[model samples]
Target: MFKRVIWIGGGVVIGVVIAAKAEAYVRANTPKSAREFVLGTDQDHVAERTLSSLWGQFRTIMDSREEELNRRYIDRARSARH
Candidate 1:
């Protein structure tokens, strides 16, 4: 009787844990915004927005790095010659 009770309790705990994990997984994958819900926006729109933002950031970083390289090399060389 004690062994059976222990087994049942263990099963219940495992079931609860599995259910909680599934809920979390679903929530994490679903979109969170009211606008998205109203607009019926899909995953593709979310991905495109993310990619566009990332591209903008990349361009900003690239421009800054190019300016730094020009200052470090071209400006220094010109100053040395003068």
Candidate 2:
């Protein structure tokens, strides 16, 4: 029984030490942006860039569609005028 208790205690201590080391390593290796996020800093630049890129893509698509519609309208108007 004593041997079993010793083994269990040793295992628990080892596990705790390993977990602490891993936590430290992660905190050390984390990027500034991610660390700022963990500290509750306002890191909206990433979100803003993503939203801006998506909006740009959407505007490009809409502009192409608008140009196609305008070309079609102009063709119809010219034909009717003739």
Candidate 3:
């Protein structure tokens, strides 16, 4: 019975030590941005804000490209008509 208790206690201690080490390793290796995104108060809106900003930039670029393409096509058609 004493031997069994000692084994159980040793197992519990080892498990705890392993868990702590794992937690520390993860914390140390985690990226700062990821940690901030996870733990920040603005976590809920971070993704939404990021996506919105990205979408806005994409739209702006798309519009600019479309305008350039249309201008080029019109110019080419005009030149061909001459």
Candidate 4:
């Protein structure tokens, strides 16, 4: 079970890297289409910007939020322990 979990997780990481590289490639080759879509130019633009970019953006946003929540949680936990 543990091995399978690692295998699946590794596969997911590999897929994300390939997709991000692909997205960066497409953005380089097709900036007008890829770049324009990031804005509110078209509804489909929301879907066109590869999952990796979206995930990368979300991961960045969430990491900050997670750190904040962790700090608060630790502060509360430490206070309660006293």
lDDT of each: 0.73, 0.77, 0.77, 0.75
**TM-score for each candidate, following the candidate numbering:** 0.47, 0.46, 0.50, 0.41
Task: Compose the digit string of candidate 2's lDDT tens values, residues 3-78.
Answer: 9999999998998688567556656888987767663364435446556888999999999999999999999999
Candidates by TM-score, descending order: 3, 1, 2, 4
Model 3: pairs clashing at backbone N, Cα or C within 3 Å: none
Candidate 4 global CA lDDT score? 0.75
User: What is the TM-score (0 to 1) of candidate 2?
Assistant: 0.46
Better of 2 and 3 by TM-score: 3
The C-alpha stretches of model 1 lying farther than 4 A from their native spots are: 1-44
Query: How much is the lDDT of residue 25 in candidate 1?
Result: 64
- Model 4 vs. true fold: TM: 0.41
Q: Enumerate residue pairs that collide in model 2.
A: none
Model 1 per-residue lDDT at 73: 100
Q: Put down candidate 4 lDDT per residue, 9-76, tens digits, no spaces.
A: 99999987886676566667765865665544553454465556889999999999999999999999
- What value does the lDDT take at residue 82 in candidate 3? 100
Sort the candidates on lDDT, descending order: 3, 2, 4, 1
Least well predicted 10-residue stretch by lDDT in candidate 2: 38-47
